[model samples]
Target: MSARGSVTAGRARSSSRDSILDSAGRLFGERGYSSVTVRDIASAAGVSAALVMKLYGSKEKLFAVAKPTEALLTDLDVPVSELGAALVFCVLMRRERGLREPWAMMPCTIQDTPRPEATRAKTRERYLAGTAGLMKDTTPDLRYASTVVALMTGFGEAVRTLGLFDGWDFDELVAHYAAIVQAQIDACQLAGQD
Candidate 1:
């Protein structure tokens, strides 16, 4: 093929890969990881199941790579002090009616798989890394970081699993939850000073 043809082909491949990942992310968020098949992702992306398997190797690998946590965390774009509100925005307030944040569903995904200790370990490490990054110079103790993560995850899961906050006003719920999260961050900051 000509050089121009090669470039075009590369672009096509990249586009297809992105489409597959996007579709997989959405499907996984909506249906939970175990429930979503590569065929389902392929259908959503308007591609063949074989193509997805060929590109990602397998369903588990695809789920691991297609996790949206890194993107979701980076997109917050706020100071460390306000990270809680940012998280609340991404995981809770920003979703459509039925869509769940992929990261918020990750623990459930990890639970559903057999012998996923390695995956779970990686996820725990990533969670700590990401939280530490958000904590910045706040002297991020892993214990506090884990507690903060649990708080955010608990709130998000409560909203998702039990519709715990659905009846409350959106702004009010976010405010109260963000305040609670902020308190944790504040406590961490105070502890760091000692």
Candidate 2:
């Protein structure tokens, strides 16, 4: 094959790979890992199952690549006093932009997958650890960090997954929810100082 032909083929391959990953991410996020199969992702991506296997080897490998571990709060520089609002605002903005919060899918995965223990471990390592890191300056208590994580996860699930507060004013929702989160943070900080 000519160099031009090789380049075209490479681009096609790259596009297919990207499509597969995109499909996998959406399906796993929506339905959880065990509920989705390679053929399902392949069909969604408009690629052959053989191609997916050739590229990612297995469902597990594809999941590892597709799972997102985005830091819960991208900008952690917010003052502790305002961290609640910042965190709530970030999540709401992402929802408005139609972004998926993979950590919010943990409950689905835990309930749906056969290997619940493994799923729980992954959640702790990837999701909880990352969120806790963002709160390191506010408190060193794992219990407090876990509470914050729970609140965010529940909030995301209710807002995004369940559409509990659809059509609500963004600012109003954020203010109400952020106040609850702020109370938790304040208590944690006070406990730490004692």
Candidate 3:
């Protein structure tokens, strides 16, 4: 193939791969891991099951590929004080984009799968690491860190479930929720210093 044709083929392949991932993500989000199948994903993406396997190897690997864990982790890199706001903003942005809450899938994967234990464990560890990173303090109390993590995840889940952002100002809600999250982090920081 000519170089120009090769470039066009590469773009087409990239587009197909992305569409597959997008279909898989939507399916997994709508129906938990246990409920979704490779065939279902292939049908949703308008690809053959064999083709899906060829591209992603297995259902588990496809899920790992579909996950936005890296993007989620990057949200945790903001200033510790803005961590809560930034985290919540990330969730809201996903919803605004009509995408599923990627973090929410971790619990489902853990509860719903017997295989892929290592993948699930890695995801859990990453989530914990993100939580710990938000503390930004040496010797952070484990209990306090857990609370902050729970609050962050719970707030996001609740907003998604309740449609709390419906007809509301996104920025205002983010600031308000961030204050609550910051308060918890502040307490943790103070506790460590005492």
Candidate 4:
């Protein structure tokens, strides 16, 4: 083939790779880090498993670029109540839209190892910082803020598992989790309350 033809072919291959990563990102976010397999991602990307492996090295590597953890972490300028609203809206919508990975839990395979702990710690730090930006200043203490973030993540995962929000619209589900977390925060405010 001529030089021009070869250049065009190379561009096409590059485009295909970008497409593959886009699909993988969506899958990883929706299914969670562990649940999404290389095969699944490749199939979604319309590529072979070997290609996925060759291009990405591994799912974890692919995830690093495709589903960036830092993108979701943010400093909220609003109050805790508003912050909760934004989180429920974002995380749940992400789940519904296949953008937020539903699986953050450490799988049985990694249950005894420190491998998953590091990722979890990063997630925890990022998530809390985002949540804390809102509650940190107002709360008498930031201690419960960690609990609040944990509850939100865990409950959000459960809600996805139970499929309880299937028919319920996004706004409704956001309101629900927001209320639940708000209650927890409020309870924390009570001097004697645990």
Candidate 5:
């Protein structure tokens, strides 16, 4: 084949792969990780199941391409300089939505698979490392930022398991969570020797 032909084929292949991954992401986000299949992704992307299998190798491989860890990173509402706060906020929001989030779901994804699990570990580590210093600043409130994120995540899961989401309003819940954080920060600043 000519160079032009090769280039065209490459472009088509990339587009198809992108579509497959995109579809997979949406489906995974909507349905839990275990429930989504390669065929589901392929059909959503308008491609053949064989193509999905060939491209990603298996259902797990498909997740490797479409998973939400980095996607959450991209959606964080923080600046590069204030990554800790951004990460904290991101974790809070995700936890508010419960573990159905990329964080919780990714763990579920790796729960059984023998595939490389390092990426999953690294992601969780990165968030903790990223938020370490900022979370430590809660003297008045003592660990307010850090505690909020941790509790927020745990609360979501606990509530979801208990089927409590139906009665909750996110805005009110976030406000309630924020109040806890503010009290911590205030306690810290007030304890200063000034």
Candidate 6:
């Protein structure tokens, strides 16, 4: 191929890859890993099954690429006193920007996937442990960290997945919920000092 043709082909390939990843993420999020087949993802992506295989090699590989790997509350640069607002704002803004909430999909994955145990383990490792690690400076108790994770997950589900407070003013909602999260952190810190 000529230089120009090669560049065009590369762009087309990149587009196709992105489409495949988007479709895979949506399908896996909706139907869980085992329920979604390579062909299902390919059809959703508007590409042939052969192309998906050629690109990702297998359904598992595709899912690994498509799945959300980052923890929801990874940014801890803010002062510990302001962490709750920072974390809540980060999650809310991400949802507003249409980013996937991995925790929102946890219940479905645990119930629907072929390997529920694996899903549970991954969830604990990715979310619970990761969030707990961030909370270590505030509290040594894993239980407190776990509760914070649960609260955040439930709050995210309510706001994003269920649309519980759709019409509420964004700033008011953030402040209100941030207080609840902040209270938990405060309690954890107090307990740690004792």
Most accurate candidate by lDDT: 2
**How does candidate 2 score on lDDT?**
0.76
Provide the global lDDT of candidate 1 against the true structure: 0.73
Give each prediction's root-mean-square deviation over alpha carbons.
10.9, 11.9, 12.1, 11.1, 11.1, 12.0
TM-score against native, each model: 0.59, 0.56, 0.56, 0.47, 0.39, 0.58
TM-score of 4: 0.47
lDDT of 4 by residue, 1-194 (tens): 99999999899879878977887766654445666788888888888889888877887788778852212435233455465665565566466545543333323324555676876666656666655555553455556677777776576667665666678776677787788777755554563334
**Prediction-by-prediction clash tally:** 0, 0, 0, 2, 6, 0
The residue-by-residue lDDT of candidate 5 on 104-178, one tens digit each, is 444455565566477657655554443333434424433544454465455445444444544667556545554
Model 2 over residues 1-194: C-alpha lDDT tens digits?
A: 99999999999999999899888876665445666899999999999999999999999999878842233554355677887886777677567646676546768878798898987888776665665566553454477678877898899888878889898898899899999988877777778787
Relative to the true structure, how large is the alpha-carbon lDDT of every model? Answer: 0.73, 0.76, 0.71, 0.63, 0.57, 0.74
Off by over 4 Å in 1: 1-71, 137-141
User: Tens digits of per-residue lDDT for model 1 on 75-125?
Assistant: 455676777766676565335334455556878988887868987888777
Better of 3 and 6 by lDDT: 6
| lDDT, residue 107, model 3 | 64
Clashing pairs for model 5 are 138-142, 139-188, 140-187, 140-188, 141-184, 141-188
Measured with C-alpha atoms, the lDDT of residue 46 in candidate 2 is 100
lDDT (0-100) at residue 131 of candidate 3?
77
How accurate locally is residue 104 in candidate 4, as Cα lDDT from 0 to 100? 34
Clashes, model 1: 0
Cα deviation at 99, candidate 1, in Å, is 3.1
lDDT of 6 by residue, 81-146 (tens): 876776676566556546776667677778798999988878776776666666553444477677
Name the regions of candidate 6 deviating beyond 4 angstroms. 1-71, 137-141
